[model samples]
Target chain A: MKRLPVNRLSSRTSSAIIWIVLLTLPLWMRAVGSYTELGTQVVVLALAAMALNFLLGFTGTLSFGHAAYFGLGAYGAAMTIKYLVPSTPLAILVGMAAGTIAAMIIGALIVKLRGVYFAMVTIAFGQVFYFITFRWNTVTGGDDGLSGWHRIPLNLGFTTIDIEHDGKAFYYFVLLCFALSVGVMAFLLRSPFGRTLLAIRENERRARFLGIPIERHLWLSFVISCLFASVAGALYALLNNFTDPRALYWGQSGNFVIMAVLGGMRSFWGPLIGAAIFVVLQDYVSSHTENWMSFVGLFFVLVVLFFPRGVLGIIRRRTMR
Target chain B: MTQLILFNVFNGLIVGAFYALMALGLSLILNLSGVINFAHGGFLAIGGYLAYALIPFVGFWGALLIAPFLTAFLGLIVERLLIRRVYGRDPLYSLLLTFGLAYIFEDSTRFIWGAQSVPFQVPDWLMQPLSSDYFFLTGYRLFMVLLVGAAVAGLFLILTRSRLGIRIRAGTLDLETVSVLGVNVRILRTLNFGLGIYLAGLAGVLAAGMLGLSPTIGTSLIMPSFVAIIVGGLGSLPGTLLGGLLIGVASGITTVFAPSATEAIIYVMMGLVLLIRPRGLLGEEGRVQ
Candidate 1:
């Protein structure tokens, strides 16, 4: 494999600088109390986008229905709090478990189809989930969604924290999770398995000939990506304090794909960039015009036509030069 | 029970014709350009809307003639500018790109025509009953059945007999070789795309009268059209026809029995088919990957 000559230290230092700058901006906003709620929502969306990036950017598998897992997580958390347990920790765990299981089941069937088939199957499964949520009014509340679901209070043996009462505290908790997930993802990408996944993406036939179990690798990547997505979903539920079937809708899934692609599917932090751009655009556009969806659609067309590689791709090109 | 079954079967075939039209275009584009064309439904929506728009001024026949050609021209531009660039790249790029285009088209339609369902009335002349007996059917539906059958026959004749069809078949068979042999493969591809869109437009015009026009109608139709293409073999016209009829009948019967599970029935059938024969009923083996 040909290696590009790039300085490790400078990159690490710059990443740290970027992290510090990003982390402080939220704190700065909170201090000023300007658009703090919107800031938290952006952070949550960024986490979901980053999770999608794991498969889309790193593994080169485009999933049009990742929101299935996202919705699963949200519902799992919401249901857990509603029915059995009200502990925040327990709800989060339930969300993660639900998402992982759903991913594994759907991944097994869908991972068999390559490229377009795979994308289509995932989309169908997402639709199935959406339909189930919509029709099963007893559980999911159908279209109206589950409301009045109280937030779980965080209970550590030493300290009990009520996240609902403190928006700043909840924001920090989400930020911490985002940081941890991104860290783990970065580590995985640097590992041997990550390199192998890239190899598979670049040339699946070659990878298969080299004795790599391509199907198993893809299945594993799909499950892992869904797990990350579910965690984001759980956080989103916490932030919104409600869960709905809309979380699993095809449009929501498209939003995730748009974010990942817009920010730069090839870049490590492209989804984060993409999520920020998407959420901000939605915020701005919806406020200005009733036909905001058309504008968003226009953005998608422009991105596809002009920037095939995404925002991160453009950045990499400039930096490489 | 016999009367009910016959009625459902007739209804199924009517719907099936529309599905066949949409799936045929999708399958052709997939075979020739290696694109599944997520925007195919968008073009279908355009056709439906165009027909609706034309109903006030030019009547149904005139709208049917003008709308599909307009959509075909739009498809030509899409192929020339957007789809052509990504032919040799990863298939996912085209999928994502087309998906974006679908979003844009759907949203643009919503913006132009409000989100409310638009009314499209079948012409009074075509609204008469075909037979006054117990086995009742409308003239418009009979007209649709004949129109689709004629369209299919016309498509078949062109593909089998026409000079352009020969070039298209040649390009589909071996693109690089055909290009080497001095045929402009790109032009054939664009023409194929135009033809596909034309079919979608025609289907849309028929559907707008049968099923009301809504901006989101295309989104709902796209998945079923995909199922039809996959179940039929990708790029096989006869296979698409068979797939479309099968799905339409299946859905129609399910709707009669369990209306709530109507959507799931198609996907369940797809899963079952995949399990039994991954290449689909008429799909050529090893072409699917």
Candidate 2:
């Protein structure tokens, strides 16, 4: 149900168009008066929204505190590079591990709950990390945020890629990660385990009747979703060479949820499209006015009222006709 | 040391009262409407700012009495226009709607009032310490406690005794039957949302007197109220009230020993309550899953 494999022909064609636009984005972005970094940012945030959709769209879990893990990923990566090692890849691993581990613990606590109660508990749990980061200023740099740490170059034993100095190389690097992450997610969504998740989403009572071990599957989905989000978080820290407590705040979580929803949470590529629009709009808005937040808020209200089905969802409906 | 502890305990109680007040309002909307009301803090800010604006024209006492009603009026309109459309839909839309509303409220407040903290004056007599020995006892603090107590009592009485209150309680339990029984469910929900916003507005004015008026003031209190609701028990008003006070006291007690853990301790309490009673202390049994 994630997609109509029945519509495989059309999906393949559209996916081809998607890849073509993304792969050559760096080349044409200048013509559009945008930089490669913005492209990379869209890719990175798209990855995050997609990860959130893994749980939210597929499993029907409404988690509202994913930013905690994302922030954990960011802080973990930043800390590793600043204090222990300057290796970029290792830092990403450490960040992912930190976030995923925490998710495992917290996911267990929330798996039994359904719907809004689950959402509320996740939100409450998220603040624990936020408070820790905000209060542990000595180690975390507190409110000033973690800075002075930079993304290091990648040495593949054959050649050294200067990620720090070359913007194009870094953009390619992030795009590569995005491709790999989405590929894995797509593959999983097509698998048997994935169908089980779909079952739970469609009808939890029926899924339980089939002995799908509902809570266990949910925990796995939660952990997987978080792992992907944390990876995006690491990339985000690399993108900026800075991490702040704001990364873990619940507001950031809301942004991710909106991205997924606005993109068409039911579709695989919906979040990516949503992320692109959101990132570009946000970049444009913040630069133009101090009241950018209100504008963004207005966007949300309008979307909820008018475009709740999202761009992809509407497109699908039109195509079906 | 005794004086210091006592002062903090009392201080915690005041803070707890604020949490209880806000949480009670939030709970009302959540139970009946199924909207998380993320913009709640935004409405709270509106209430505080409304009072601030009114104080210049009407004086503090008048603003205190009038601001919440004004805020609730705004809330009723918002519910009628915006929130009503999303009723019977997924909770996600309402949450996102309110989240956006929160952003508007915070930014608008900052834009209008200037982002800096604004002084909201109380009367001189209320500011005076009652006695040298119990110097922390100010008339204003006492007044806040008494007003909150009355409000809480009034709320409980309205639910149990009044016709509208009983209707609201019945609606919360089952909306279909209530609607089938000839109760206008639409008006009921609108009124209920107003009641919730009214509580938020009242909390705002009281909070402004102690914390001063700031765009972020409502946000700062919103989480504690959330924690209070969870720790007390979901769908239970008295539980929310107790949760607020309990967490307030817990944080207050923590401040005496490990000052930094005050905020963290509340979450810790939430975790403990979850572990021991997954649905919360006073949460109804069926609500657990």
Candidate 3:
């Protein structure tokens, strides 16, 4: 009881520190021998992992196929820019809508399932999108990926932010989007819906007996989670200026899940830290060796065996002790 | 046109047989231990590659006999070393562990065998078409079908008649009760994992012969197997087998009409199954949870 105030204070301090670091990342990135693009990637992937944690950590549902929505968002943004309209904001909205709509349908179909079965069905469904992107060569560029499009600069009527040409400006642009998404997520999590989700996660049967509509809540959570994931995916497309079927593959879903797990699924900001570590580690290792898969795999094994609670989890445990 | 459809249906059956083989193994491990063995495909690849390596020394016949056992032995070691620790934890940890193992397996195979597709040889006699009317009906295809049938039959026989098999089935239903009844649940799970991996291995070897042997040979087949499980029913092995065959035939038929949608067809079937029968064709009532 005595530790509660101090705990709250420390958490407040930590979040502030995290924000400071993120705000200063571009300035210090080169000094630390990393580039701005890499920092942008970390934020993008962190959003994805956090989105996944929305369902996995809070709702107690494990979705192993989130990459489908991520990929959908990426393709939606890319195609909107390349084929439909060249407006960046419109592309992001279209991408988000595409992913959310797909999630609505898919979520409805699989909402009744629980645990391992749900994860299995999700993975199987994800492959459908992956196959679509891979085989629809005329539209999607098939295995070559959807290229020849780039993110356009934002026009705020009075001022134009040249995100296309300026890497640092783009990084801040991504960070602003992240901040908005994260703020909304944090707000939603503090609401009654989030509390109900926690209830379901803790004890589904008890929550059901208490008159909560389990399937509806699960479906809504699934959709909301995919909404943010798609947002991240759209940002990811802009960062790269290209999108591929690999973005939607089950393997990518696995990466998102690992990021959530690596950061500490139970905490709000855990996935962000997980994403930063994973993105950096992957970038570094892939650059150094062709056998990077082995290293990544080994890292996963070590994390599962040793650090299953994650970095944030460890810190929390120590503080609690 | 009829011939084309028939050819595809037949082709689909063969592919379905492979899916059933892999899904059955996956289902066994999933049912008993609650671990989705993502590396089941990796095990399949190992089985194929191990057979490929042994073919020179032991000949094709000898490799077929030896390779699955070797793969199963590896499965037992993996279960003992890694998979055993995460037995009763959140399914996420086990899934992640297996997913990692999958990455390592694919990478290791690529490192060892090179990233290029390697030629996996069948006997010249087996390579010949059994009939001119159905050129797809090669001796090797027939042999593969026969062997898969025998393996499936043998698996069922063991499950029904053998002590270990019964224990596995029992463990799948109520592991705690089985454990309390003096069965060493640890050994049961270890052996169960090995049995599952053995099927994966067998499927891998058979697949390498039919498809080009690449590091990703197992990876490509895995999603279909998952579909087979969902379509067939989660808790039922026979259902998984049927699901596998159904999807295979469905895709094969689809190929004649829409070649681009062949891969997507099984998923469509899965969606339909989930809508019509959420528990799958053979899935048990309470096993879904």
Candidate 4:
């Protein structure tokens, strides 16, 4: 009957508290009926942002063109359902696979460059992808994007759930997927591979000298990040029921960078918070003013100048103190 | 076919001049401040809009002369207030900060100018076309090419022979070491930034005549300018010129031949160059490697 160590107990209790709180809130919000779609949007974006955090926070790599992977996932999922299979699970798998392949190819060449050159090369590659989508009018439907896409259908042999018919149900489906992805990411981060990534980010030359395969780690991180982004993209397409070429645009890629920075780059949960704040602010401000772009710009400037380490960083410092 | 090629060449030369002016400014600022100055495009946009505003009062030539100076003054203020704080920090921080500034500048321009395309008229004197039996070129375009050539030559002389230019170059090569030797490094950095902005403004003015003044013009031009810099090798003046003309010619010719793949052509060129020489065509070995 000896008392468990305080640190272990505190950690276990905190995780229990977090899960209990998260589990109840969705149910409580569902009772209120207003949080369904908003909750789903948050979940999807948070998932995407978390994927981005893997690269930005853990690996110290800033990608200016991650939307290419996101768009690839969305397009891949949609195309699979349209052409080969209408099964939701298969489509998602196809989307993730496509994203992984694309990332492996691009990341191999790009990971060699460092700093701003790396960022610009990614941007350039994104533009190349954008141009391909725009030019391949028959496949992608060009700039207009492909619509009339079907939703992911759940077929459990005996029961079927059409996701598009119920927003709350679809929200739950996405939330569940997000939870799985987050769990996977958390596990990966806690693994030895994740420790190696952190080590490489801290001192790449030192890591290389210590017998770490630096390039392989970077490529793996890039591919894994891309896979997560693609999953988010696939879910986003399923939620929206449409896919457009704009998804692959450089501006879209820039948005991910903005989101990553807006959330504290130093913390795991920062990008999720960043995405939530960004999406909410954009929706609110654009509704009120035609000059939303200017307002967003002003906000961005203030964020860079005053809160350089971002909101989470500020919070962490204060909490630590 | 010959006429089309000639037209594209002429167009490329004129566009290349604007590219050179913009890239020259960017290179100078990069050398002096060790920052990419992503807001360089915003300064160009301001010059175009300012020229657009001044077109009615002082006419195009007068506006051309005055607008860039005004934009340079704005650049000076930006450097003093925002850029100076993050001078010795990580390069990524500066890049992100300038990117944010670029967004602010771009959106502010849209808010002020109402997001519509502003018509920029070439002066009546220079509106005529230079024609031969086989090919024709616009008089204004030809003028722009000559003007940019003279400006390049003037800049070269100033940097190589003039006392101020020598100090600026000395400051660029080794900022702290030169500062310890009693040179005013901060002032030189400010001047370099101002000159860079001035060149951007000049490009904007020229662009107003060719592409017409618009808020979206900066967004469109920024990528091409970046492509020129990357292809020519960063921080090299001559490289900027070579990169700009190469891109301009390639883009123009590609548009003429394969309209659908025009946007793709720049990236294809960048990829080919990166494959062969990752540091760029004229980039110093191990400079950006």
Candidate 5:
């Protein structure tokens, strides 16, 4: 405590602050004119954005098709509850498995590609899932979206958590999942494998020369990223109790990417902050006007032009100076 | 059945032509500037709407001639203002910028055009069937094919024969070397982007006649163009053309046996192409890899 490094100290304090804020979000949310659902939405999307940043930020790979996995997870959970079983935990697992399997197959196919080609292929591949869901009207409900399903209440052996009807309880459930995913990600990032990913991201050719199996690592990273994204997706389905093809569209993938960029791809908690801002802004603007797309688009432009390093990136830069 | 198959094949070819036109422009920009230009579809919508707006003031022929030029001008302005700023940055920034531009364009078009499908007019003479036996062959369809053919031929000529074309090719291969050789790489990229947008504009004007004219016309057609590029091979213009036609014909034939799979079939083709030959049917091995 007498001589703690400023960076390390600040980081610890910041993370502590973030946790306290998130933990007490439901308490203060209404006082600030927000609700529990919006807080939950922020947590869900933040998890997604962080998952995306795991690939885009840590691995230095651009994937523009992540919505495919997200949607797959959503549909998996929705369909499980509707057709297979009504267990909430089972639906989440099934959703996660569905997305992971898809990612495994697709990642294998596109891992060899780099740069824009990789991005392009991922986007195109994502559309396959979108079209399948869109055209399979009988099963997927097509353009109308999958409905008539609700998130089942968690039935723990010791006690039951009625997250189904209680908005605050659901927020806590989503928050618990978010914390677990984020903890795992953070642990992974601090490990040697994560260091290797950073090495690859920094200098792929150099890392390749050092005998790092670049493609295999990239594929694994991609799968892991999508796995967590699908977890977020499953929770998203539970949040709304509905899922649609729009969840898997490339445009949604783009939103995930923008969130990562906006939060600062270089930092761990950046996407969480970014997601909060994005979700809140979207809720406010869409409520105010029908031309929200233009505003959102203009925000993207402004961010690209002026805040390319993102909010946290700027803050970090200023502090470093 | 034979007549139906023939009709679908012909219809597919025409659709393929549109894909080729759009893909070629996208390829030109990508090759020269290394930007994917996700806003390419947005430009196509602008071209369609611009043509639709001009038809009453200028005749259909006049609108057809002027609309593309107007769209190209807008493309040039966009390039100069926004796109050029991100040229030297990471490819991610450019992609995000274009994605934003795409959103803006789609939303702005909806705002201006009222979001409903507009009735696009073509000359009555052009809409008439050429013959009762081949009743599917309307004069407008034939004219679209001829005009597209002329445009393709003209583009190839310019690429191969003109100094600007040679510079563009050289630039695509290595812009640094081209820049050192006294060519203005900045102007080259600008013109290349404009050229690409012109093709999109042309496709948009032609498409409005055949399909419903709406803001989403660009969005629906844009994906196939991407498929065309992938099937054709990256960095290969002629390959894009062949890929477009191949998928078009493939999907067209599929319509005869399975109408439901019309849209899905192209994606299947793309998947197969990726599996069999990741480098694409005609893509250079060293290009995308």
Candidate 6:
């Protein structure tokens, strides 16, 4: 199928290069005057963006409130660790489950809406979780944020890695998770179901006429993307050893969409690249000026006006020439 | 208890009026242009700040009348300059552009006015309670309701009676046909956008008085406006008006009983509306035009 522009061989070669570059990122990050935490953040946020891309770039739907599920994952993991069990794997699973369940419920309500209406409703619905986290203060820590919880070290049967202290170890762990998630995403994108989503994106009327169950498929795509976003959120909570209502805020959802768009929504790995630039720029800007928000907003304006096609899109077009 | 219920309901109506005003603008743009205008709240904050600045010179009533006009002027500029560029493109670009504008607007407001909440002055007589039995029925509140009522009535009149309003309604239903018939669509859209922003500005001025003047004011009120549009049925302005009031009263009542669920209650209504009437309470027969 001629879905993505790049052929199978180039895709393979790019993936190989990407894996090598990512594996060695921790080592070179310091040489480039960045920390391991930044790399880990890029990985986590990229995953969220990619998850969003599943629906946005592929399914042709706009959801401005995916952060709700992401926050749910974060809270689910943090709460699981702090209140239930301290196991990392179990916490991740719980976080994923919580996010998936929330997505299912919200997806059903929203599947019928399209375009801007869908975007509006998703954003409005997103605030429900934010309010819950903000108001259910005693449990979720309200606006002050969920504090007192820390990411515990992972213990495996063969060996226990002290991820609590060693940032590099944690980075590698996050990279592994990123790999697994992206791998699943890529595999699915090549599947018949994935093609159906792409078909929907390309032409909804045609896809509908092909006997595709529109709302049901949309719900599935929404739930799936939320699951992925929630996993990223889970990773985010672990990254800070903290969780907050801000994680689920509508702005965060906007960030994910921007990342996906900034990376080139049509390209599978585009959001990762977008997340990297965004994280680095945000880090540098905030450290330098108090009016960093203006700069960030300006960045959005510039990107939309001049670079709507994104970095990867530019690259692909150039290479095509 | 009845008095308390009455107080909350009235307060909710006032709040709902604000949402309806904001939603009406949002819906106006969405119906005609297909852009979500995420920066609308930003326009609102600007209106409040403009009124705040003008109050020294214009007085309370003058500021109320002038601030929204100034905001509409700014909206005209924004529509002419920034928003016009993104119009024939994917809906995503417009959404993002406005989203960015929102960020810029909020940050600039904070930068200029300071992040702290400034007290908005209402004339002393207007603040007085109208009667002992319904002490909560303050004159200022009644005036706000009347002002909002007038604005809604005026909007309806324009849409039905005026040439520009008829053009907008016609453009909304069939822009191509209207354009082919020799209407200046670009001008129509710009005016329509200004009209929407004018409502936003008015809401901003009133919201400043009631909610306290703050940089965060725009962000806080925006979501409910979106909810109002959704619940009211996407294309229909009257539906948006009803949706805004319904959610407002619902949230208000919830505040009286389960105060924490006040915001949550509106979203619950949205969910129920979507399930029961997917097109919304007054939503048109199909997906958004």
lDDT of 1 by residue, A88-130 (tens): 8788889989999989977877666777766766776787778
In angstroms, the error of model 4 at B177 is 1.8
The DockQ-based CAPRI class assigned to model 2 is: medium
Better-scoring candidate (lDDT), 3 or 4 = 3
- For model 4 the local lDDT of residue B221 reads 78
What DockQ does predicted model 2 obtain?
0.78
Kindly list the per-residue Cα lDDT of model 5 for residues B1-289, writing each as its tens digit: 8999999999999999999999999999988888988899999999999999999999899999999999999999999999999987888898899999998999999999989999999999999999999999999999999999999999999999999999999998999999999999999999999999999999999999998699888888888898899999999999999999898899899999988789889988888888888889999998875
RMSD vs true structure, all candidates: 2.5, 1.4, 0.8, 3.1, 1.6, 1.4
Residue-level lDDT tens digits of model 3 in B226-280: 9999999998999999999999999999999999999999999999999999999
Per-residue lDDT tens digits for candidate 4, residues A1-321, read 343475457556655774564456557766765466666777787788889889878998878778888888888888888888878888888888887798988887766677666776777677777777878888888888878778866888999877768777787788788889988987998899999999988998899999999889988998899899999989887888888888877667766766777788777767777887887787779889987766776676676678778777897677556
Off by over 4 Å in 6: A1-6
Q: What is the lDDT of residue A313 in candidate 2?
A: 95
List TM-scores for all candidates, in order. Answer: 0.93, 0.98, 0.99, 0.92, 0.98, 0.98
The 10-residue segment with the lowest total lDDT in model 6 chain B: B280-289
Residue range A269-316, candidate 2, lDDT tens digits: 999999999999999999999999999999989989999988999999
lDDT of each: 0.83, 0.92, 0.95, 0.80, 0.93, 0.92
DockQ head-to-head 1 vs 5, winner = 5
* Chain B TM-score (model 6 vs. true structure): 0.99
List clashing residue pairs in candidate 6.
B232-B239
Model 1 whole-model lDDT (C-alpha atoms): 0.83
Q: Which stretches of candidate 4 lie over 4 Å from their true place?
A: A1-35, B132-136
Q: Candidate 5's residue-wise lDDT over A18-111, tens digit each? A: 9999999999999999889999999999999999999999999999889999999999999999998999889989999999999998888888
Segments of candidate 1 deviating more than 4 angstroms: A1-7, A30-34, B1-6, B130-136
- What's the true lDDT of residue B167 in model 2? 93
lDDT of 4: 0.80
Q: CAPRI band of model 1?
A: medium
**Of the candidates shown, which would achieve the greatest DockQ relative to the real structure?**
3
* Model 3 chain B lowest lDDT segment of ten: B280-289
lDDT of 2 by residue, B148-213 (tens): 999999999999999989999999899999999999999999999999999999999999999888
Q: Which candidate comes out best when scored by lDDT?
A: 3
Q: Scoring each candidate complex against the real one, what DockQ results?
A: 0.50, 0.78, 0.89, 0.50, 0.74, 0.75
